[model samples]
Target: MHKSQEKIPFWRVKKLNQMNSEEWESLCDGCGKCCLEKLEDLNTEKISYTNIGCELLDVDKCRCKNYAKRDHYVPDCVRLSSANISSLKWMPSTCAYKLLSEGKNLPNWHPLVSGNTDSVHEAGMSIRGRAIAADDAGDYEDHIVQWPK
Candidate 1:
């Protein structure tokens, strides 16, 4: 197809809020770092990532077990939306939503760019096989890791 006739990707053509539900959902790279529990320093407001996966996260698949009902199961779960994306200071640097909202393009490992969902895992960006279930994790402090940042 001619360059003018080629269809641009939705993410390139529309803002986050203008995307449909499916388009918005597809932007997630499925790295699972977002599902990991985090700790915050009250005095300095520093955020620390942990290898402990949320109760609703499927550690192996790196996806939520019940995404539609995650809010119901985890009352404290922070839902990422166009409205709140800017204020989420703790969101991982590799997060697609964060990147796009910051006027950056998606990384090559992003599923949308790679055309393969496993690319994120293959790039060693996903928490698959690395995260422990929340129930099995003894202490959040002990699981603190720097990779997610």
Candidate 2:
């Protein structure tokens, strides 16, 4: 096809705020890193990630068991939206929302690009087997990890 006739993806042509609900939702790569517990040092204010998954996170699937009602279970749960995308500094660097907001392209292993839901896991990006359920995690400090950052 000619360059003029070539079709562009909605993500490439539309800003985050301009996307419809389906288009916006499709950007999530489902890494589950966002569901992991985090800590911020009082002195440096630097954020640290932990292997401890939220109580509602289904570690194996890298998704929340009660995504629709997560706020009821975990009050502090952050719901990412186009308006709040830029302010969520704790969001993983590999997050599609974060990447696109910063004018970057999605990685090859992203499901949207790979056309496979398991691509994130295959690329070792999802928290599938790495995260320990919060109920079983003894201490958040002890579970501190660097990969999610």
Candidate 3:
């Protein structure tokens, strides 16, 4: 008979500061939805997600075009700091960070769980092959959409 397996202590179980670099990196599902440009209603402070992406985002890859110096190119680029994870309001509802912050379990499609990098894409959660470069998208209004809708 196989012996009982030891449980893996996930980052969600630990506080942000408790996570090491590798654990912190694994938190990302890499859907690239967060990289998309968003509009906030200044009066109500409500945010609307758009299909339009940041100029530095790679449409298919859903990663920063210049990750090393992202802040240099995009002055407002948010560095995913453990210190700010709890307060970052714009993170997607499906994001692992948000899910964990709210004490929810990670979804089955998450790469960390499925051990498949393309699972997000296979689940239709990714921006792959669907995004148009920001520089090429003329009007922000034109890019407005709720993907599942």
Candidate 4:
């Protein structure tokens, strides 16, 4: 924790919009939990996270299969914007977007802070092997995963 060992830049000390591209991209913890399909109840407006993930999500790495054309493949796929981060409700509790928007610092396990992208999976913050691709799971109702964590 000494000043000499602190590699995090001052930009990381700023808010989400104040960060440069490198800092911004590093904020994504690569948990892949956000990539999972969520269904919202029309009446209650509550969202339910299914075990189903997008076809592009890599089951092992918990990253996108197609990062560039994801918007084309899934038209509704939200490209995180400065405007949207604060209101994104379904983002995992450990998500960087939710954290920054709430005026909190990134957790120690975050890839950006830890300097290792795989730290997410190591800390069990990533969905990883738990996610089943939507292509494999036909019925969503049957695949609802109520994660106790």
Best by lDDT: 1
Model 1 segments more than 4 A misplaced: none
Candidate 2: deviation at residue 134, Å? 1.0
List the lowest-lDDT window of 10 residues for candidate 1: 139-148
Q: Per-residue alpha-carbon lDDT of model 4 for 1-149, expressed as tens digits? A: 89889776653567778877877787788988888888888999988888888778887778898898999988988899778977887777788878778877888898777889888889888897798877789889887776612
Prediction-by-prediction clash tally: 0, 0, 0, 1
lDDT measured at residue 21 in model 3 versus the true structure, 0 to 100 = 84
User: Residues 75-109, candidate 1, lDDT per residue (tens digit)?
Assistant: 99999999999899888999999999999999999
Models ranked on lDDT: 1, 2, 3, 4
Question: Candidate 2, overall lDDT?
Answer: 0.92
RMSD of 3: 2.2
Alpha-carbon shift of residue 149 in model 2 (angstroms)? 1.2
Query: Model 4 compared with the native: what TM-score?
Result: 0.88
**TM agreement with the true structure for every prediction:** 0.95, 0.94, 0.87, 0.88
| Candidate 2 per-residue C-alpha lDDT over 25-122 given as tens digits, one digit per residue, 9 for 90 to 100 | 89999999999999899999999999998888888889999988889989999989988999999898999999999999999999999999999999
lDDT of each: 0.93, 0.92, 0.82, 0.80
Distance from true location, Cα of 128 in model 1, Å: 1.3
